[model samples]
Target: MTQQKAVLRSDGFTFKQFFVAHDRCAMKVGTDGVLLGAWAPVADAKRVLDIGTGSGLIALMLAQRTGESVAVDAVELDEQAAVQAQENAAASPWASRISVYRDDIRHWTQRCEHRYSLIVSNPPYFTPGSDCATPARASARSTTDLTHDMLLNCAESLITEDGYFCVVLPTTAGDRLLTLALQHGWHLRFRTDIADNDRRPPNRVLLALSPHPGEEFLDRMTIRGPDQRYSEAHCSLTRDFYLFR
Candidate 1:
């Protein structure tokens, strides 16, 4: 849980398998990011790509999840965030398997030569009228930096025929993504609606899109238990990485 704090490192957060330094990032590590990272399928992943890899969290997670031969390519546009992501990757146990790029995903997608077996992104989701103050935060929150069409088109072309592109979005913003993916010939093969607890409604949606349209698998995840502690499912999903879990 991003809501849960790590053993306070001087400049980073500690996990059971890795450490992340996000103070230089506009967007610090959050639950949505961590959840998307852990939940993204890596069953048979060979080469993976992580777009908008803030603090290199998801890329590192994939490195930790994949077989020893798998290599992870992560892209970040933010200069400071990219550097921090690079540093984080270098310090991790899977340092040699992860590479951090300091470039915009839109541009990076153009130059990227590798076709990934799995692609995951946690892009900016704030719609047109949000009260964001700083440029970094705005870049992290607003969609101006990376559009749905740009991400989908690139993913459609770069992903393997059997590959899947997964993303985490706000519940409301997911509608546009669903529509966009269909328009681009990608299908929503799986989705998970996430909520804080069993009582409250979902606020986030995790989507998995693929070139081949198949039966849509829908599911739900609650982060906390009735007693307000971490849920069994949440803990189990993240048990491999989180120390407290």
Candidate 2:
């Protein structure tokens, strides 16, 4: 187990077909990114866009899911992280189908030529005024740099008429994000509340929204069971990404 940790440490984390390097990025790989990458409906998607793609983890996961024919593009505002994202994608088996850019989504939406079938973001949702040692960490976690309005406007401009936008957020921010999404002509298409255990309140919400309203799909997921092992549902959702799961 110690040796296994060392290997994972060297490679960041190993996925079925790719490895993500997050040492230089402010945000390391986490469950939120994995859940959003897998839960998103990408089977029919031809062009996918990932915003704020720190470490390129979620984008790489999506690239694996979408296949070689589908094009996946990601944008990261942090320059160092963007470079790391580009490198990660370049090293992946699906390298030819993935592209990473060092640009802000707000600006990218203005001139984006390709219409995306799906757009995703595990956005920074925390409000300002918290203490964080690193500027990058604070920027990644707090909305002082990125607001829900910015993300929604970019999605509205870049997504196809029938396309979907997916995201995962802490429950507090997720509700507010959903409210904002509704105001801007985006409606919930699917939703799943995520809890660590069956007994605990949901800490995160995975959401998918489309331009047209439909019979909203809803579900709940518990990450761990009574035995303190991964719940079956959680394992199934992430089996493709986690090594030796």
Candidate 3:
């Protein structure tokens, strides 16, 4: 299959089953969010949580992948982004299965009694002092508002005994999360190093962690091949959700 290059639209991103309108979101639809949405372990996830669900992209993706029995909750802190997320989910085919909450995950977790079987986040990984174009973008990208420690603690409190907490982060930041997860008694279940091309060192990593210890799976994925086309492995992983794959 010839892979059609994906264009990043300012208004929204159109997937195979739904459209994500991200005009009001600080963070627009990007490869990291899409990658985490499509690749996270969702086989038996009865209840899923998407933290910082800008435009509700990952939540909607999970809703599309899971059975009708599943329910997905999306939490966002930013008002505009949260509203956009809610609108996006409401417009999707899986509207009934997805719920959008406009609150900080830490606050939401305190009031919520539900435990999730699967939780995924394309979290704020940039260093706190890094400069961004806008305050909203800064909040979305940097750890000042939602630090790694806070995220791990929130996930730890909300996850069931056998639940999986997955995230996509830049390789350096991912390593920090890995260390923190281990320190917090979470075990690594899977890891995927991703690079723009095989010749380049990985710039991003997909990590799946669990409360129970298990054999860890590690692999590498290159988004583009030598000819600069989408690699077969990347295409295979995302084929279900990408319209032009």
Candidate 4:
């Protein structure tokens, strides 16, 4: 039998419907972005916003999940990453539905007149003084630039009355965000605690909040089962976008 070899590259990631080239991005493709993209509620979303759209992964995913009538606007602060996101969106099947803007979310909110039905972000959660390997990574990880309060305020300004604001964060940061959101008059609609394995406590949390109050929905998910394989829940949740699911 003839033998063949496959070469792997680190510059980009391939999803089921689109490719995200992140070589220029400080934060490369990661589970948090994918989870938020796949897990965020998108039904009947006429317009969607993706904050801090590095590599444009979530924006592209939202474009794929949404119908022709839906429009997705993505904002990124980093110049190189914004260009990369734009290129990725242009290459995707839903190019017309996605718009990439190289601007801070804070400024974008001021200029944007239209309200979005849904807004999502895999935001920087690391506190200042957190150890990081690079300045770019530090900017992408640390909250020194984008505080939770600022994020919530921006969402409040841009979201429709009944719109949903969703984010994925570390458990501790997520808990703080919950409190902050409530203080800002936003009500929690859904929460999902995420863990690496069945035996460990959840290390991450997915939160969906809105201005309108509703009965809170809570759930838990583990990325890996006891067998050390991808859990069924994880697979099922990401099956639509993950190439291997």
State each model's CA lDDT, in order.
Answer: 0.87, 0.89, 0.93, 0.91
- Which is the better candidate, 2 or 4, if ranked by lDDT? 4
Model 3 TM-score on a 0 to 1 scale:
0.97
Return the TM-score for candidate 2, rounded to 2 decimals: 0.96
CA lDDT for candidate 1: 0.87
Q: Which stretches of candidate 3 lie over 4 Å from their true place?
A: 1-8
> Which residue pairs clash in candidate 2?
none
Candidate 3 residue-wise lDDT, 165-217, digit = tens: 99999999999999999999999999999999989999999999999999999
Answer with 2 or 3, whichever has the higher lDDT. Answer: 3
Cα lDDT tens digits, model 2, 115-234, are 999999999988897778799999998988789998898899888988999999999999999999999989899999999998899999999999998889999999989987889999
- Give the TM-score of each candidate: 0.95, 0.96, 0.97, 0.96
10 residues in a row with least lDDT, candidate 3: 1-10
Number of the candidate with higher TM-score, 1 or 4: 4
Stretches > 4 Å off in candidate 4 = 1-8
Q: Which regions of candidate 1 are displaced past 4 Å? A: 1-3, 6-10
| lDDT ranking of the models | 3, 4, 2, 1
> Candidate 1, residue 237: CA error in Å?
0.6
